[model samples]
Each structure stands twice: as structure tokens, then as C-alpha cells.
Target chain A: MATVSVPRAHWSGRRSTLASIRLAVLTFLADPQWLIPSMIAPIVFGFVSFELFLGTPDLVVYVILGAGMMSMWGQTLYGSGWATGQDRNIGTLEPTLSAPTPYVFVVLGRILWNVVSGLIGIVLVFVVVVVATGTVPSIDNPVAFVVLFVFTMLTLAAVGTVFAAAYVYTRYAGFVQNVGEFAFYIGTGCMFPIVILPFWTNPIALLFPPSWALDALRYASIPGYVGFSWGLGWDIVGGVATTAIYLLIAGIVFKRVERHVLEVGNLQEY
Target chain B: MSSVPAIEARGITRVFQSRKGFFYQDVTRTEALRGVDLTIETGEIFGLLGPNGAGKTTLTKILTTLLLPTSGTARVLGLDVTKDTERLRARIGLVLGGERGLYNRISARENLRYFADLYGVPLAEREKRVNEVLEWVGLTWAADRRTEEYSRGMKQKLHIARGILHRPEVLFLDEPTIGLDPKSARETRKLIRSLLGEGVTIFLTTHYMFEAEELCHRIGVLSRGRLAAVDTVAGLRDLVGGDRTIEAEDYGFEDSELAAVRHLPGVSKVVSEEYGPVTRLTIRVRTGDLTIDTVRQNLIGHGGLQVRERRTSLEDVYLDLVEEEAR
Candidate 1:
């Protein structure tokens, strides 16, 4: 046999990351099932809150933010976490995981796309709330609101990555995802203030990254909302600190889980 | 440099655990590969031939770094598969036979572009490389068609295209021509030949005896999770020790007639199976000692029977090795 040497260029992790993100986006666009539910959940919640609040501006703002964030939670759990199971089902997981690119980056890219897709639902819900109540919630700190929103999305993406890794070992990933979607909604106060719940649950809720992010978003978006009265400075500190902590934990857990999966030869298992 | 083997396995083994029953407390372990060692020098097309469940695919997975060995080591391009998985993956490619791996909703071009990106091909060359591969696989005309719309043969071609898209130094192909039509299988073989000409070391696993005999410079036969034999096609045929095969068809044979044929000199084995009205008798005998004429005369002495001497093929060698291992 003849010998031919093909020139190999250095591999760029950033380029592979972008490609994974693009593939995730294209896959989501082609499959409307995930998008339909993400949009409908917020719209339905917005309509219900519109009637219950009787168009009161303060309560309407609460409902809009709650429903919008709830949609994000759903998208993260199903679109990002449960998507690992979908990849296994479609037989693409092994190939994607075995590629030269880091599997963690591929997963991060996927969660990033889910965050982007979830934004569509957030915007649609905001539109529905404004059109129904004829009131746009006044923002006390637009800059803080944007920063907290980004923080919340990233925190959720990290959480989704952790779940994606955990789901690799279980055959009941879909069931787990369904349970997690509702668990985060209730645990993080996406539908209502955690203060209304039992006092003992407050500390647990505060430990979750999304809860702090929600609190920050609520404080920045709704004037006089009952959270972090100290000001936007504390909100930023709390949101960023908690998000960083959650991301740190998620990164460690995901790395270990990914190694276990590859070592055990379970990449093909659903 | 040519002395270094492109692929090498040292006592590689893999075991899978399965849960049994509803409570799931019970665990059953199955050994897929049992200390199997293999080596393929650079630019050689090495074929791994085996029956289903013979650990061929498991070994391929280990060599490709898709599965870790249970208690052994494998290397590609001189890099340990376990220790240098990421770097090893970049230098080698794998094409597992099936239509399931590719993204079904995306066009072939899109799929190839995505994999090119995953392989970290430079942005400037991604499009050119994808197009070149598509053209090589003869799928440039259907490059934009969704893979779900492709035929099985077309999908197999696309699979090959993806495998070679990265221009890896080694490529592992598991049953590349499986389930393909005769013409498509032929085309795939031709593509494999062309790839070999380019100096890509191919580790191929297939059930097709003729394909392995023709394409592989050397072939390895695996049976029951172990390497039964590894040699050139002709060398393997020599394992039967110059045994000649005689196939005869007759309208049902009496037990006494079979016993008479079995007791003949130089006869090693006689296997008879009923195929509708006629019973086919396959007889193996020492070469140069038994001729079709003598065998036909002996059978005809009892009753008129049709007999033909058959050429020894790779299939016969494979069966012989497998049967020897079974004993």
C-alpha cells in the first residue's frame, strides 16, 4: 500500500463549540414540538394571570415575569436536559460524544441554544401580557435587569447541563425531566413568591441559582417588589455569586458523570 | 516510520452488565471481547471477519475510543486510546454500519458540514472539504437532500463520506457494505479500494467472505470473543490442510449409503441436509487423494448421483477456524 500524509491543522475548540450550537439551533428549528409547548405554556399562564389579577399593573408584572421564567425552566429541563435522551434515541449521542471536540462543550453549546430558543417564549409572553393588560411593567434598572436576565439564563443552562449528565445513567430520563420541570417551577418560585410557601423552604429555594436570579429580575423589573430592598448592587452580587456557585458545582458533577459514562461503555444505552 | 503499526491492540477485553428481572437487583455479565490482540501496519487494509456476536464490532469500538477496554489497551497512530482519547479521535475516523447515526432531518451537506466542524476542520477549508467528500462518495448530486430521503445505499455512502471527511490517518469501518444491494456493495468496495490507494489504513469488519478475500491484505477471524486465526486468504485456506470439498445432490439418500461414503478413505467429514425433495451432501476429503470422478463412481455404485468438486473459499476457511475453536 502507498503512504500519503494528509496535513492536519490545529483544532480550534471555539470553532467546534460554534458548530455544536448551530446544529442544536437547526435541530430545534426543524422540530416544532419543543417550541410549541414552550410558547403555549407562557401564553396560557399569561391569560390566566390576566383574569386573576384583573389587569392590576403590579400583579400583572408579577404574572408576566413568573410565566416567562417558567417557560425558561421548561425549555431548560426538556430542551437541554432531556435532549440527551433524545440524542441517544436518534443514535447521534455516541457520534457526538466521541467526536474530537470536548463533549462538555458540545453539551454547553446545546444548552446555550435552548436558552436562545426559550427567549422566543419570553418575548411572546411579554407581548401577550402587554397587549392583554395594556401596561408595560416599568423597569427601575434596565442595566441590572439585562445583567440579571443573562445570569438567570446561564444558571439555568448550567443546571440543564448537570441534568443532561445525570440522565445518561438512567433509562427513565424523560420521567426525570418531567419531574424536574415541575420541581424547579415550585422550588424556585416561578409561579409565586416563595414567601407565601412554608418558611422552612425559603433557605432551600435561596440555594438554587434560579431563585436568586428571579429575585434579582423581580427587584430590577418591578418597582417596590418585595425582594432585596438594599438595592441593585446586592441583587447583582447575589445573582452572580449564586450563579457562579451553581455553575461550579454543575461543572464538577458533569465532568465526573461524563467520564463514568464513557468508561462504562454506556454511551449507546438510552 | 513504516515499521510502526497504524493500529495495535494488546489483550483488549470488554464486559457488559445487564440487569435482570423487575426488581433489577440481579446482574448478569457478558464478556464481549476476551483478551484479543491484533495489529495492522500502516496503509494496510486489515479485515476482521466473524459471525454475529463474535466481538468484531466491540473490538472496533475499542480501537476507535468509543468504548474503553475492560482490562487491556488499544492504540491508534501510536497514541493510547484510553489515555489520549481526544487526540486519538482526531487522528482516526469511524464509520459504523447503519442508517441511524446521521441527522435525518438535515441535508447531507449540512450533516457533513456539522461533522467537519466537530472534527475542527479549518473554517476556510470546511466547505471545500465537505464538497470534496460528497463528490467522492458520488453523493454530490443529492448533497442537499435530507438523509431521511436517501436510500439505504445512499445513506451508507454518506456514512463513508463522513468517516473520511476529516482525512484521518486511520479509518475503522464496521460492516460498511451490510444490507446494501449487490451493485451498491460493489461501489462501496471500490470506494474502499480508492481510500486504500490514498494510504489510509482501514480496519474493516464484514461478514462478506469474498469482500475480505479480495480487499484485505490480511484477515483475522474472530469467534466467541477470541482471535481464532489471522493470516492471508491463501494462508488461511491452508489451515484446512489441502482439504477438497465435494458437493452432491440426490433424491434422498439411505442411511447405509451415507455410512458407505463416510467410511471411504481420505474422507474427513460428511454433512447432509434435506432441501425439499433433494438431499445435498457436502463431503470434505484430503486433497490430491480424492477426485470428483472417484467420489461420483463410489456414489453411483450404490445409485446414480450428481457430484461436483467445489473450490475452497474463504467461507470454508472461516467455518473451519470457527468450528475448530468451538471444539
Candidate 2:
């Protein structure tokens, strides 16, 4: 249109997860308000638990873990799904889906960014708990605690991939998630240990990968704690197995979701 | 390059079903596309013209690999659009220009760069290509500005920039100049013409008749989800009677006089319309043998007769073809 000085494109670009992550970072930076709303629940959970666990330094660790897990549940677990929902809102879903790169990689990039933001939420909860109690609860193995903590988030991510596919499957997924988030929290024993819930509900809780992953994290962080088969070995095995299955489910679900959306021709509806 | 048609479609139809009401019991099915068959050779500009509800966008989406057809098949760059979408997507570009389809919060450069990644552009070439497309669309001055701040014309340019960023062999543009200013719209047409030098086949759908006549190598008229006609400008004119129009006006025309004009040697169709106290008769002439003087002589006794002759236009041919299909 103007004086032609620009060159034509060739082959476009190779799909790179790094580039997707960079795009996520840039989008978040541009719209700082996105992180604000997702932060509210974790902070409230932290302070509420801190007040209940008052005067017991030993019990205080659960508050921090609960708060952090709350952040991880919303951000790390379902980040990619909500990001897909956001794509629908912005009307970028059709273009991105029409692109050469697989949509899974785009969701993966969103999940990775969500993991970082989830960690930020964890930090905020930690600060909230420490300031509320004025005492820092101690952990015996900080390295294992941290590793298991991140591992739990990764496990949640595996399950999150399926939910991301759900977002692709329908635009109403966010509403469904909102209606079911509390049920999910209770099922996964996000705040309280699943052991305290009805014994018959263990199977339902075990369906969630984060259930096993979070229990393992608590065992590593809290002292004299016993949850879900009472040891870390089975918890890790269960977490890994469930995470792999969820990851597998994510693959199958994505293929079907893509097909469904294409057939329905509703990618542009939102 | 391969000799296959850049785009080929056969019996492609799309029907959308939606459920409404409180219990979602009502089912409504809309057949957006009927059996449509089309082919466009490499490096050709193919314009699809239709009114509002004419399935042009539906046909375009099927060819672009965005939506699946309810029946039949489509191929772009020799790959099946339904089965080989990923592969076809790499070689084709699409511009669905509107207020949407952009990350509004980010800068235009950021949006292009993100799409470059999605399109799988090489790392070394991404920045250069983004800059190039920005300059090509004449958005170089506003490249770093956020898209939310852009005017509709600027955003339209950004859509074009993204569509051409990947150097697609076939680019499908859906109303690329809808909201652009006169100067910008002219520049966009110029840009579209220049892409032909690089062997890009363009499939454009627009409501503007002048645009189709100006840029299309061949054009298709779609009405009520069915294609009425597809031909070159001259060929299409000939399809609807002829390329010439003759009009005769008077206080009124007797049936015998109208019959006399219709029976004239090159006149194909004679239709009459009343304008207050005047009756205007339109004649579609099929050959040069018919002239105004001959028509007036045929209408012998008519008083205050006015006669005019002019060449037919794409709009005239398009309306005739579409109205035929609508019937």
C-alpha cells in the first residue's frame, strides 16, 4: 500500500512452545488486571485457614499448603482452559485453531504461563499466612517439599489439559467450571485432608491427579502427617499414573473437540 | 509449481443446527451452503459476490479449512480441506477482517509476531516478515501501537498484514476493505493486485460489484446458498441477455408497440415499468443490430418518447443471475 519496502513471508514460522510462552507473558503484561481476580480466592483461603489454625505452629503449615494448593487448583490446573475461554472472548480461537501448529501446544504454552502465575499466587498466600500468624512454620525437607509442590502443579496441569479441551469443545465450559469449582475443591480435598472426608469418597477424590499429588506434597511439608494410604511411595505412583492417564485423556479429548468444533462451525460464535 | 487448481470444491454444503428455548427443545437447522462446485486456477483472483445470507462466507470457510462441509469435499493446494487441514493451513492464508480476530490489548507487532509463531514461521524470518507485512499494509507508523487504539481501517490493514504474513499460495479474503477509507480501499486493491506477481491465488468474497469487476479474473454469483453463475466479466454479461441496455420511455406503451420492440432483430427482453405518468420500457439487446432509432421506429405512434442506450454492468448481470436463482 505504501512504498513497498517489506519482504514477503515464507513457511511462516516453526511452532515453538517457547514462542507461545513468550506470547502468554506479553499478553499478561499488557493486561495486568487478568491476574487480580484469580488471586482473590487463594488469599481468602490463606487468611481463613490461618485464623482457624491459630496458636498451633504445627497446624499452621496446613494453612499455607491449603492456600498454595488453592492457587494451584485455579491457576495451574485450569489455566489453559480459561485461557482458551479468553481466546473465544477475543475471537482469536478461529485464527489460532486455523494455524498450522497444533492447538495443544497453544494450550500448553498457556498452562506453562499459568503455572508461573500460580506460583505467584502461592507466594502471596505464603506472605499472607506468615503475616497473619507472625510465625513461620518449619519444614524438615524444603527441597523435597518444593519439588513435590511443583510436581503437584504439573499433575494438575495434566488434568488441566483435558479441561482446556473442554473449553474448545464448548463456549459454555467456563460457566460449567464455575458451577462445579466448589464440588471439585471438595472432591479433591483441596483445603482439608481427604482422609477426614467420608471413606466412601476416597475413590472419587483419587480420580483427580492433584488429590494424590497434593497429599504427597503435604507429607513432605507437614510433620507427622498421614494421608491417603499413609505414605509418599503410593501417592507418587498414584499421582504419576493418574497424571499420565489424564494426559492421555487430554489427547483423545482434544482430537474429538477439534472435530466437533469443525463440524458444528461454531468456532466464530462467541 | 503443481498444476492442480489452487482451490477445488464439489458438492460442498454446510448445515448448522442449534437448539433454543428454556429447555433447549427447539431445534433449528440452517443450510448455509447448498451443493456448490467451483475451481480456481493458480495465481487467479476469484471473487464471490452475494447479498447478505448468500453463503459466500460459508463457502469461503470450507475452502479455508476452518469449517467442515456437511456433504462433498474441498481441496486447497491439492490437499483435502477436511482431512489435511493442518497441511493446507500451512500453505494458505485467510483474512476475516472485522472488529474482532485480534489481541486488542497488545500492539500490532505483537499480534503479527504471535501469528507468525502460530503459522510456524522460522525464527530468523519472523521479525523480518512481521516488519515487512506491517510496511506492506502501510501500518509501519503504527506497528508498535496497541490494536485497541486503531481505527477500523487500521485494524483492517492489520488483518490483511496477518493474512499475507505467511506468504500463502492461496489467500482467502472476506471483505478486506469493508470499513477502509477511499484512499485506503484503493491502496488495498493495489496491494491485492501486487500479490498476483508472487503467484498468490486470491479467493475474495465481497458485496461490492465494482471491486469484483476490477480485480477478479473470474467471478461467481451466489444466491440462497446456491451458485447462480461463475464466469469472466464479459462472459457473465453475455449470460444475462447481452452487454447492452436500451431504454424507451413514453406516457404509456400499447401492448402491440411493446411486442414490436421485443420482436426487433437483436433485442432479447423488453420489460416495462411505470414512473408516475410515464412508462419506461427496458430492452436487453443481444446484438449490435438493435439501436435506439430502430426501437423508436418500432414504437411509431408514441408521443414524448425518450430513448437511451448504455453498456450493461457487472451489477446488472449479477442481479439478473441472483434473482434467477432466488426464483
- What TM-score would each prediction reach against the true structure? 0.93, 0.94
- Chain A only TM-scores, each candidate in turn: 0.90, 0.90
Q: What residue pairs clash in candidate 2, if any at all? A: A12-B120, A12-B121, A13-B120, A13-B121, A13-B122, A14-B120, A14-B121
Model 2 CA RMSD to the hidden true structure, in angstroms: 3.1
**Which candidate should be chosen as best, given DockQ against the real structure?**
1
Model 1 chain A is weakest, by summed lDDT over 10 consecutive residues, at A227-236
Using TM-score, give the best candidate's number.
Answer: 2
lDDT of 1 by residue, A127-146 (tens): 98788768777777888788
Task: Give model 1's DockQ, 2 decimals.
Answer: 0.65
> Looking at every candidate separately, what fraction of the true A–B Cα contacts under 8 Å does it contain?
0.60, 0.60
For each candidate, the alpha-carbon lDDT, in order, equals 0.82, 0.85
Over 4 Å off, model 1: A51-57, A228-238, B249-281, B285-289, B297-300
- What is the clash tally of candidate 2? 7
Q: Give the TM-score of candidate 1.
A: 0.93
On the 0 to 100 scale, the lDDT of residue B175 in model 2 is 85
Query: Predicted candidate 2: interface RMSD?
Result: 5.4
